[model samples]
Target: MKHYLLFAAGKDRPGIVAAISRILYRHGCNMADSTMTRIASEFAMLLIFQAPAGWRAERIGQELQRCEKRLGLFTGIKPLASSESRALKPKGRAHIISVYGADRPGIVYRVSRCLASKRINITHVSTHRTETSRAAGYVMLLEVELPSLRMAAGLNKSLGRLASGMGLHVSMRPVETAKL
Candidate 1:
């Protein structure tokens, strides 16, 4: 079996998932994990799947040749190594940060850079910008892993300070996970 990471994006529309899944199904691909979402009229996807032996990258490409173009999607595929024995999980506790305020530049960069400076890892992020609601001009939800929960208070304070300067509201809280 071969592991692959597939990315697909295009204008949001109906039947996109079915079309993509059909290609994988025909090629005997088993989807391990995937995320599909629409951001401002654009549909984006990140999929991890296992392809049966003998399905080369070129073959996979050929199989989707018509699918992407027909569906107006842009696609990319890359082979991924599955060496679990050599992988080590980062030492940290998960935290979710919420930020929302008027839309402007530097919000994402500044917040992300702050976490980067501390070697914090961002596992996932979702953002939305709205023109209809006055509640929040822009909103971002980020999932980050902190080196220690002991520093949550201090870090949250710093984040609050940073966000306040930018006229935004920010809050951070730990995420509880279950093994089973």
Candidate 2:
């Protein structure tokens, strides 16, 4: 079987999965992994599926288009290269980083740049602006993978310097993951 990555986005509504799954079922596709979420007012889905070896990517995309038309979703598909598939899994320590400050531009960019320079991989991130003391404030929660050589203290120090420069409060803590 060959693996393919599917991306779909549309207005948030019910039955999106049923529509997508029906098409996949007809095409003899098996969903191996997937994540679906609502971002803002839009619904987005990312799926990794396996199909028969001879299946053409274009044919699956056409099927997806048909499903999209029926469900009012916009869809895209790509065949994942073997190397790409291997790199998605996280390695090293998993940590959660949080930053809070008065709402302003460049908070995310600055913090992300610092992490990027250190080769830190961000697995997931969520940010929001909310009212605080009659003023707007921002909060960001980031799940990141820290390199084996860098302990939590090192990460904290780096984040602290970035936060000091940006006038933000930053905290980093290791997250314990239990295998099921």
Candidate 3:
């Protein structure tokens, strides 16, 4: 079996998953991993599937086009590259960086810039504005992969300075891996 990645997006509505899954079922594809979410008004999905031998990406694209036409969605399919199929394995510590402050521009910029300078890798990031406590509040949560040789103390110090200058609260802690 060969792996392929599918990207699908469309206006938010019910039954999108059913439509896509039905197509996959008809094609003898096995879904290995998938993520689906609504970012703003659009529904988006990224899926990885294993296709039986002789199943070409182009054929999948054609089937997905038919699905798009029937469901009023947009779909794209591509074969996953051998190198891209292997997921990243973190070496050192995993930490969560949280930032909260008055909603304003450049909060993500300033914070991410500092992390970038230190060669830190951001594995996941979720940012949003919410009405809690302050009238206008911004929150940023980032899952970071810290280098094995870097000290957490030094990284925290740098982040503290950056937060102070930006008038934001910043905290970094080791992320718990096990689930209860």
Candidate 4:
């Protein structure tokens, strides 16, 4: 089997998932991981799927083209290299980080870059623009993993300093992983 990634975005509406998943089903693709959400008025989805040999990206693209036209979604499909499929496992605890304050450019870039420098893997991130004025505010929630308890303390302090410098409020809450 080979892995592929698909991204689709359009105005939000009901049945978007149904329509897209139907096409994938017809194309013999197995959805391995996916994320779908509404950002403002737009609905966005990213799916990482696996399909049998000979199921090329071109085929999936062709299959989704019609769905995209019908659903008014801009879609893209690409093959995933083996290296991209193998992600690093978290060696420690999971934490949710929230960042918010007056909106400005580079918030995501700066914060994420800092986390990357620490080798903290960000599992998920969602951001929103809340205010629409001279002091517009933005909010971001990130799920991150701290590789060690010691790393957590330093990370918290660093994030605080970075947030203070940017005039943003940042908080980190540790999450308990469930063993089912």
* Best-fitting candidate, scored by TM-score: 1
Off by more than 4 A, model 4: 81-88, 132-135, 178-180
- TM-score preference between candidates 1 and 2, better one: 1
Clash pairs (backbone) in predicted model 4: none
Candidate 2 overall lDDT versus native:
0.85
Clash pairs (backbone) in predicted model 1? none
Which TM-score value belongs to model 3?
Answer: 0.86
Model 4 TM-score is 0.83
Q: Which regions of candidate 1 deviate over 4 angstroms? A: 84-90, 132-136, 177-180
Q: Say which prediction, candidate 2 or candidate 3, comes out ahead on lDDT.
A: 3
Q: Taking the tens digit of each residue's C-alpha lDDT, what string does model 4 give over 1-180? A: 888888999999898899888878888888888889888899999988888878667766675788788889998888888667665666668899999999989999999999999999888898988765566899999998788888888999999999999999999999976799
Ranking by TM-score: 1, 2, 3, 4
* lDDT per residue (tens digit) for residues 1-180 in model 3: 788888889998898999898888888999888899997788999998888898777766777788898778988877887667667688668999999988888999988998889888998899988886648889999988888636678889998998988889999999887878
Judge candidate 3 at residue 170 and give its lDDT.
Answer: 94
Candidate 1 matches the true fold with a TM-score of 0.88
How well is each residue in 93-114 modelled by candidate 2, as lDDT tens digits? 7889999998889999988998
- lDDT of the structure predicted as candidate 3: 0.86
Task: Write down the TM-score of every candidate.
Answer: 0.88, 0.87, 0.86, 0.83
In candidate 4, position 103 carries an lDDT of 90
Hey, what RMSD does candidate 3 come out at?
Answer: 2.5
Scanning candidate 1 in windows of ten residues, the lowest lDDT window is 82-91
Q: Which window of 10 residues has the lowest lDDT sum in candidate 4?
A: 82-91
State the weakest 10-residue window (summed lDDT) of model 2: 82-91
